[model samples]
Target: MPNQTTFTIKLETELKDAFTKIAETEHCSVSQVMRDLMQQYIERHEYKHFLEDKVTSARASIANGQSIPHQDAKAIFKTRREKV
Candidate 1:
């Protein structure tokens, strides 16, 4: 299990009321809904970082002449698909 901590925030009453109503309709507690939203936000940010890192690595590899030509890669994949 992960260590749990409390987070505090202030928002308009109307926003809070709307969010609480949605959570209730979904059969979730307000805390659980907030936690789920936080987790989704974290995952989205982390995935963006992951994509940036991959793009950086790919650019470096291309600059170093370590990548195959596009047409060659496409041909290789075509052959692979035919084999499969």
Candidate 2:
């Protein structure tokens, strides 16, 4: 891979062994596996933060009683769509 930065990471002995075995089985280097895992980890971390924000917004709306009943909401949307 071009334009890639390298870094050293410490892993538990057992975890290192497992990663090495997986790399061998997948016909790739441990470094490649770690890179893929890190990418997935970062993506999940970002998505988690987004979900947290959404949860917080929902909680605030509930606390402020700024919500309509679910059935009323659906009916309103249906009427709006029909008008559109």
Candidate 3:
């Protein structure tokens, strides 16, 4: 098994109660549900960063006159597709 650590958080009683009820309805432990939620949040955060980096790179390429025109790129892809 992987090494594990405990995390602590504070929330309102009503919020905790509602969350616990939902977790029970789903037949999942509170800890497991929290873990799943944390993983999803992390995945979304990382993907946001990935897209930001891609946009920055694309902008830099355009500024440096290194990007091909749309029609030329489309023609190139069309020829490649026909070769397959």
Best by lDDT, which number?
A: 3
Residues 1-84, candidate 2: write the lDDT tens digits: 768787987879998888799899989997888788889999999999999999999989989999888999999999999999
Q: What do the candidate models score in CA lDDT, each in turn?
A: 0.96, 0.92, 0.98
Give the top-scoring candidate (TM-score). Answer: 1
lDDT of 1 at 75: 100
lDDT of 3 by residue, 13-56 (tens): 99999999999999999999999999999999999999999999
**Candidate 1: which stretches are off by over 4 Å?**
none
TM-scores for all candidates? 0.91, 0.67, 0.80
Provide backbone clash counts, one per model. 0, 0, 0
Candidate 2 residue pairs in backbone clash: none
Q: Which has the higher lDDT value, candidate number 2 or candidate number 3?
A: 3
Q: RMSD in angstroms, all models? A: 1.3, 3.6, 2.1
lDDT of 1 at 48: 100
Model 2 is weakest, by summed lDDT over 10 consecutive residues, at 1-10
